[model samples]
Target: MKRNTNYYIRKAHRYLGLFLGIQFLFWTLGGLYFSWSDIDKIHGEHLVMEKKDFSTTSGLIAPDSILIKINSRQPLTPIAKIELVETLGEPYYQLQLMTGEYRLFSAKTGHLKPQFTKDEVIEIARTYITFEAEVKETELLTIVSNHHEYRERHLPVWAIAFDYEGDPVVYVDAVTGQFERIRHNSWRVFDWLWMMHTMDYETRDNFGNWLLKAFSILGLITVLSGFLLFGVSYNKREFKFLKIKKS
Candidate 1:
């Protein structure tokens, strides 16, 4: 009976390890990097300006109306938020749409005015990276702000920084986005932990499926099997650190 039990256990361990071997290595490498590196910034926090020049009445106004007034020829795209500001005490509004910046105008008149733009928003994300100099680039003006709506999830605002070539480097938002406070995400390491475990940066389908559970079981088996294959007797050695003696 004991021999039969050992056989089944060994066989089970072997197959489980075989199935999970590659994934185990992936998890090991990813976990190692995540453990040592600052990998929590991948999913940034939401940022909203507290110094908004918005009154409750204006905030209630439809953002589409604001966008149409700014650029009568161009149509207003879907946006995450609308901001009203007083530049040098002059009232103008900013439309914080998906990626590009559009000026907001009075609903009654289609008047374009000098106001906040994308360049100004990016300066907000830069402050979190410890960048000291003011970042003013027209190329970055084309950057698209990323907005994720979870509906019931209360997702934060995220602003991405683009290089001279308009490539992304980092993200920030109010809880982390632009023109808002700088809050790092190291405290929420699980976001990176999830990415490291699944190698899925753009999706969440990796967690909670039967495949992941099965693979986790296999990983556990693989770890045990390798140790068993070594035949390092626990009875003979008090601790593996102690050298064995030959009779």
Candidate 2:
């Protein structure tokens, strides 16, 4: 019975390690990165520029006037929210309709500029970044790409790249002109590691994936079997200890 139990424990430990060893290493390394990596740097804090406060000075058009202008164009829909936002020192009325549509109207001229042009996007990127370099490349992405840092965000975004040290990239909402996400090399590495950790290649966000759960179970078995093997070996005097005779 002792031999049989020892053999089974040894087999379980060896095979389980073989099955889940790589995953275990990945979990360990990924966990270390997650624990030690600066979350702010991972979010591309050093890559992009900080947000400048909007001026709330006088001579700004009122929300009612903007609504009046919107009403003149077409019948009004139920608005979910309305707020004044300043972009590049220009005030605009950000209107969200109950139907889940967002509109941007110039607070000074009350003109609707919902979609931003390439130049406009570049300007927006510049406004948000501290650097003065021109946008190296700009692409309108209809679908989420693998390189995107924020995979769960809404699609139809503008990918603007800068010629900075880290090759920082910024994603902006195509329709709303909203700054969606920022990414750099560090963030890309972190994202890849996160994907491996979760074993969710498609979405990279599902922590409760079947593969991960299976590996976790196997890992637990490996640990428990290792402990059992050690206990068995100790009981059988397999581990040698140097003894000193009392004089």
**Highest lDDT against the true fold, candidate:** 2
- Stretches of candidate 1 exceeding 4 Å from the true structure: 39-81, 85-92, 96-196, 199-206, 220-247
- For candidate 2, give the lDDT of residue 63: 90
State the C-alpha lDDT per candidate. Answer: 0.47, 0.80
RMSD of each candidate relative to the true structure: 9.2, 2.9
TM-score of each: 0.41, 0.87
Tens-place lDDT digits, model 1, residues 1-247: 6556557767877787677677777788767766776533433333222354434343334546656554567665667676654433334455566855444454334355533445544654554443334343322222332222111121243445343222223433222123432323442344455555764445544576666777777676677876774454443355534554331
Model 2 segments more than 4 A misplaced: 132-134, 145-147, 238-247
lDDT for position 96 in model 1 = 60
Query: Could you give me the TM-score of model 1 versus the true structure?
Result: 0.41
lDDT of 2 at 154: 64
